[model samples]
Target chain A: MITMTRETLFNLAMMAALILFPLWAWLADEPFMITLATKAVILALAGVGLNIALGLGGLVSLGHAAFFGIGGYAMGILASHAQNYTPLIETPFLIEGTKSMPVIWLVAVICSGLAALAIGALSLRTSGVYFIMITLAFGQMLFFFTISWPAYGGEDGLSIYVRNGFPGLNTLDPIQFYGICFALLALVLFFAARLARSPFGLALNAARQTAERVETVGISPYKLRLTAFVVSGMITGLAGALFADLNRFISPTMFSWQTSGEIMIFVIIGGVARLFGPVVGAVIFIALEHLLGGLSDYWHIYLGVLLLLIVLFARGGVIGTLTGREVAHD
Target chain B: MTDPMMTDPVLETRGISKTFGALQASKDISLTLMPGEIHALIGPNGAGKSTLIKQIAGGLRPDAGQVFLQGREVTGLDTPARARLGLGRTFQISALAMEDTVLQNAVLGALGASGRPFRFWRAALGDKDLRARAQDALERVGLQEHAATRTAELSHGQRRQLEVAVALTLRPKAFVMDEPMAGLGTGGSLRLTGFLDGLRAEAPILLVEHDMDAVFALADRISVLVYGEVIATGTVEEIRANPDVRSAYLGDEA
Candidate 1:
């Protein structure tokens, strides 16, 4: 007989809720709710990316917004070029722009992965506060650069008049877009779960606990962490591309430190190192914003208080508190 | 086949030296561990035993020295690289992953030994080969019963046993163990001493320890360090008789 732990059961329930709520909204003629769920799913994807590095690998990256912005820019640039009927580059050889979501996703993942390799190589040399500061500095540098650069509307941002195309689906429809985003989220979550059980994950987890012990066992913590960082950046970048397509726009705000913080908040608020932590966190965050925003403009103050409580008392976040600390075998 | 022990030392250090600003930690220290023998390194506190061990194990780079494992120079290698070269080590303080299971820690060491932990699909615990290697090591250390227990929950002595099990998974050519007998009760120490006595047949041990009784019982040879230098090196009887070693370390105990 197959048995499930409380945490596993909780994760399944959360996934079910995510899928059903949008369906319910679609049936009730509330398209805005579907859009909001899409937003939550996109943010959850980004959070999962950060969770791989921060939670499992114990790398506290404060500059993930750089990858997110790069992804957003990838979609923006390609779509803008295609919309204007201009080649992206014509200097030596012609490289055409693309309105294809798959192409944009690939470009975004590769670009962000390369960026992560460079940033992680340098920043991973230092640990704790220095690592955090270096990552934050990198994010801020990209944010300022995007604002100053005039290629894709600079601070004004870029807008795609129509959503990018998939093979056959109408991406302009909110529920269809939600379905795509949700599917990707499910796939990434599955990958993340498997990754956490792999040998690399074991070594990475051990490195997080005692690096010296890991070294004595014959694995380089630096290489392990760098690889994780690159994969993490690629996942976040994919989320950024999806987010840009959903809104039909891309902006410098995507690169802002606040975006990075929000992504981190999803991991922390859901539960650090938990597979479905980001999903629960994203849902609650969106729900709070929607419900609390109508009550007062001081919604952020309430969020700050909630964050403080989670950090102080509820160290495990919602899932962790409910399920309790997991035994090694369990 | 000719015994390699007769031709070359299993592990050797040549004129290793280290200084921190003004205080010298290790000075012109050289040592060797022959195959199938336990070489005990003993000294009073702050006599640079730990620093010398760190240099030998690749945790610290000596200012002037060369370390060789099986006649190959390893001075330039880092800890992990040296470990990959079959130089297994354990810490003075237990360094097992506290959150992981005992088997998980052993599996990790075996994974390191395999030199291919990058595979991302299959579960580590589910790997039959890795599981067998880990289980065999644990069984050798009499820790097979605690395979699923969280490492943090183990008693201090059991943690020490797990450390050896972890090192055993490396299938190492030599072992560098720092104070493996620290924090053990008398019964635990006796049992571990007996276990280590038998372990010498698998791989030579360079044991840095404080427990003289365990040292005298297990070591094939002894080296005493004092004021950043090896004051004496000899068999157990000669070490007990050496005036310099007695005064510098053993003293009244001798």
Candidate 2:
């Protein structure tokens, strides 16, 4: 493990700044800014989850929105059923409804893991552009299904009357919710960094560079890739639960293809393999969205132009551009 | 011959052959290696020495015949599987992890012998035992100082030395070297030959080489291959004296 020093210290200082942002909002009596910061933290957690697959495992999953949406739906449906004192989706047997955050996260993980396992088994059979297309297809399939379904708001979305229960924290406090997101993001980052350095991680990288060589070393590339994919999905699913709580709403829009594309954009615009890249990317993206949205209604077009410039010239993204250092996998 | 020869033939190929569509790359190749023996596989450029070695190394599946290590059949296994069975091989074109440090590349080979490479959270850099083993392998190849250097930064000869160190990490019972001396300068070749001489006691070595001088100096036995067939197999002196080997592979003077 690398010791925290110099640039890492600077980066941590930036995080400290972010953690104290709500205090600024409190002093200025800007409740809106506090809410926005909380939202950014939750979304950043989602980007952190996606980074496990994109940054470390080199899996371009354009279908992560499915996991995120599944997580949000799990929370929303449970809350709705708890309020009604009935099962969320009963079709002759299964009964499931709890407004517990931990339970929601567990359910989200299981559902997303199973989905990723099934999709990865098929998708991993192909490489390069084919893999990207297949994941995209799966995401679109879920998106269209969510939009067409009638039970939980269809395309309109579902609203929660009350925030979900936790063990001790006040569910209404914005700073407390932000703390939960911050803790989860930190945990996920720790896991991702550990996994990227593990033997499985080495094999994952070997599989990326030379599949034949890894096979010679007695590992099947498919199994390694699928395992990483499942873990990546489970983490992303947890983020989805937090996202639902942040909005106090869940909708088909959460599972849309655009959402998947945006998450991928954040990872690429940071650094694909760097540990802190996605966090920096999320910060920049949220800031740009806020600043640019205030500037004009044609913000997306200008964003498109900026993205084109970045893609064409700056391949390594912000961290890479600043550090001039590539992601060193040993 | 000897019990070591009869007991654990470090590498054994029985009637192995491979055909790619209309081309028969290898034909009914049968060979064996005893402990401490150096066997040279000599052939013309298109004679399929590489194809035969590839089958034995588990890189290619033979269309016919079996490969065995210590009398156990392993023809169907993958390259890594064969490697774990104490079989090591180097490539003709240097198939190394060029992006990694030389020490890390060696660690990859030694990782198989060290057990349990699946622990992702544990730091490998701080493990004194693994570091010692990696250092030993690098020292054997005269690359201890170059351990921290990236393989991409090494000269071609140095990279070839690193390849040997990588193989040494497995502590292999047999080594299948595909042109280990290719493109080395005279000094580099002498260093490699010296390294091989020290390795002779450690394991049986199957050397595929175009370097005739190295072949004559190192081989305990010689096998001449012509158009995917073993035309001659004997002592270096005997192979030199044979008319068919001379006509087909060595030419008039070689």
Candidate 3:
């Protein structure tokens, strides 16, 4: 029964922009613009994943890139084995690499979800700064572990010789690839919207607002948070899989704390808990990086200033300010 | 008066004591809440009334004691486990989900007893049974009209009523209410006193309160706690006539 507000309208417009810009780029034979749009959608998807934990569960995890990197490695390791015509593992039953994008995405989600389960189990035992530090440490551990892993390229990154195949399309086509990423972002946004209204979502929101009250209600906040964190990791892992395919490269940099920071940035800039907040935030972030990066070598200084202004003047991120609703408490 | 030697108390605390570093927050206090009776625990501030309630509600562990609900030891249980065993609670400071709607808050309380809140794909609004239970609880607290209203927007009295509504859905064997009448106006207090008086017929209440008027009007039996010790345990008139209680706690205040 909730009516569409200006924020919802803005969300719709941004989604349309994502599609139209990529389509326009394809028509104009501007491959770079299409690539840029794809990156934005992929990153937005990752932010949507984080919002489930940060905005809904109030779990401020700083190591989401570990999930992102798991997805990237899932794609990288599989594609590399397929390219070299080698099986992934020589166990009792041989395990082979996959060239299917869907299969790669599945593997990515599973790996990220399990990793999240383990990390969240330990990190969630602590709250506030301790949680932030524990998650950061986990991310760093993975980053170093990947760096020392010589089988997948060690400090040197792994590259996919060819983009993984979609069921019925040439993924090499800039427009087609862009379409997949955009559609996925839309899907996760839809899922996130559904989740925010579900019973689990209500309990998670309650836990975020009042942990003691939630406990009295007989729902464990820890269990709710762990579930949200794992789901978040799964979604981000999917996004990471696509990201690696987009660039045809995976490295320790994907697991870096800087990537985790950027992912958190997308959620904050978009509007925490706003369904399409991440999408809008990702669009702005990509626009800034592209436009400003073209204008000045030290575009980050300007980006920093802009981010500060938004944080200072706008209580809610872009979508929230436009919508006139700070957080989706509904 | 009820038999003082009754062995089958509804909710009993045996020799309960708790210490926080150098502070003896709760001393050896044994109390009983018989079925269908309001056992009001009244004390001055810093008398450790809150600590006793926390131990009963499983929020705090008594260094030495046993909390029994229906004669089953529950001292080792955590808050959630104790809540599942039918120990319903309301907070003095209005512990509620501020962002959630009245119905959502009610539903969360029911969600624990219902035992299946892990349904993520289906919309909560579509669940007819859960909504019905939530609506039913709201009706009990007279908040049925504001079912969709955000909890933050409710008045202080309304919020307290909603807390009762939330607890009612727990189907509790006993109620651990902390100052249910703390912020109520005279009218609201009277309304709640009537509600609590009626509520005892379903389950006993362990009320921790400072409001003497409400306590005298609602409590079936009164227990005075002073500096972590129970000064007097008796009926309303008995406590009123006790000189020791008059000097220590009631202080001619009651």
Candidate 4:
């Protein structure tokens, strides 16, 4: 059994500080910083979900934003109907009311899981670049559909009058909202860690490296990849729900290819294929975006340049450099 | 050669042939394996030894004829499907999970006997019985000490032994090995022969090997092939004494 070392201890310390950093905003009365940190935490959770597919399964899904948006829209549309106390459509039959946070999350997971199953079943038929393109196409399809639809805010997006309610917590408080984001982020990250060490994870890795050998052992690579893909989509979908709640809004922008690219950037920047790599990447990415955006209007150009430099020179991303473990291998 | 009363041959190939467009890779080949016998399949390069093994292992479908495992038709099954039915194989190029530990690779194969491996989750790795079984297979090939080592670190001989360990994990009724003695040094060849001898009582082995000495040493029966057709099938002494076998293959020794 692998035991936690000083490095893990340090990581835990860092995580604890991260969790409390938003609390400091509450203490200092900086609502903007609290909101920004909460957004970061939600995005980090989504990145953690992507890490399961990309880092562990060697699946580079360029359409994760579809799952994210599906999740956001599930919550947004459900909440909208519930708040108005009306049906989504005439349906010629029945009406469905809006749901609370837990119900919304459950709905979001099921919706995203179904979408993932469909996408994964088709996309997994092809490998490498083809798989990437298939996912991107599905994501873009959803993105455009959301943008074109005139209902439920469409391209203009939807807004929640009140944030979705959690049990026994005054979520209206910025710090409380931040606590929810932090707790979910930590929990999902823990799940990702557990998944990477599981027998399913081992089979996924085996499929990635030597698919023929994996088949000889009686595990189908297609089944393994599809299962991983669906689980990954659900996790990312959960992150999307939190993200929509964080902003009290949902938009077609959530499903855009650019969002997909940004999430990939977080995974790669922190380090690709490492256990704590996505978390590190997300934290560093938010830091750079915050600090650089504060300095100039053209902050994105610098972000692009920084990413290029890292890709060209660093190879393994920051966590790989820090731990001296090769990122690509892990 | 007239001994046809054998009890349900563990593996049987009947008129099995494979064609790749213009090329007839394998042609109407028929062979039978009885349990507790070491069957040596000898052929020159491009004589369809690998192709024939692939058909038997269900890596390829024969254009004509069928393959049977323990009297059950298995020609339609895929590699993993055939494997679950107790047909284990070692690849020509040493197909193994190079990144995984030797113990992990063996456990992966051994886990099949119990049921689906990935489904068991935490209990699979923690099961003492499974580990004991994995260790026993490793010990048969003299690789018990190398269990924890990654496959990439093993010497060529050791890697071959590891493959044998993986093949033996399921307590297979028949093992189809493609060039099991390839790339082994003198000592390595001896070790593989010794290991095969130990396994002969437990399972029937279909060996495709270039090492004539090891083949003659371990084979209860030898099948000689030239241009995808079996020239002769008999005891090693009978094959060694046959003039056609000598002119086609053993002429190199002369």
TM-score of every prediction relative to native: 0.99, 0.92, 0.96, 0.93
The top-ranked prediction according to TM-score is: 1
Tens-digit lDDT string for candidate 2 (B56-111): 98879999999998788999987878888888788787777776678777766666
lDDT of 4 at B181: 91
Model 2 is docked with a DockQ of 0.50
- What shift in Å separates residue A212 of candidate 3 from its native position after superposition? 0.6
Measured on C-alpha atoms, candidate 3 has an lDDT of: 0.90
Which candidate leads the pack in lDDT?
1
List residue ranges in candidate 3 displaced over 4 A.
A326-330, B1-7
Per-residue CA lDDT of candidate 3, range B1-254, in tens?
Answer: 45653447879999999998898888899999998899999888999999999999988999998999888999998998888888899999988898788888998888877877788998876788888888998998899999989999999999999999999988899999999998899999989999999999899999998889988988889999998999899999999999989999777565
- Candidate 4 chain A: worst-modelled 10 consecutive residues by lDDT: A321-330
- Candidate 4 residue lDDT tens string, B70-142: 9999999887788888887888788777877788777767765555555514644555776788888899888
**In model 3 chain B, which range of ten residues has the least summed lDDT?**
B1-10
The RMSD of every model to the true structure, in order and in angstroms, is 1.1, 2.7, 2.1, 2.8
True contacts kept of 2: 0.47
lDDT of 4 by residue, A1-330 (tens): 767654466468669868678768788999988887887788877888788788777899999999999999998998899888878767787757465788888989899999999999999999999999999999999999999987779889999889989898988888888888888877777766666655676667677877777777666778888998999899889989888988889999999999888888888887777666667777777888899988998898988987898799776777766666533221
Measured by TM-score, how close is model 4 to the native structure?
Answer: 0.93
Q: Can you rank all candidates by DockQ, best first?
A: 1, 3, 2, 4
Error of 1 at B121 (Å): 0.7
Q: Which has the greatest DockQ?
A: 1
After superposition, which runs of candidate 2 have C-alpha atoms over 4 Å from their true positions?
A1-7, A88-94, A328-330, B1-6
lDDT of 3 by residue, A42-148 (tens): 99999999999998998999999999999999999999999999999998889999999999999999999999999999999999999999999999999999999
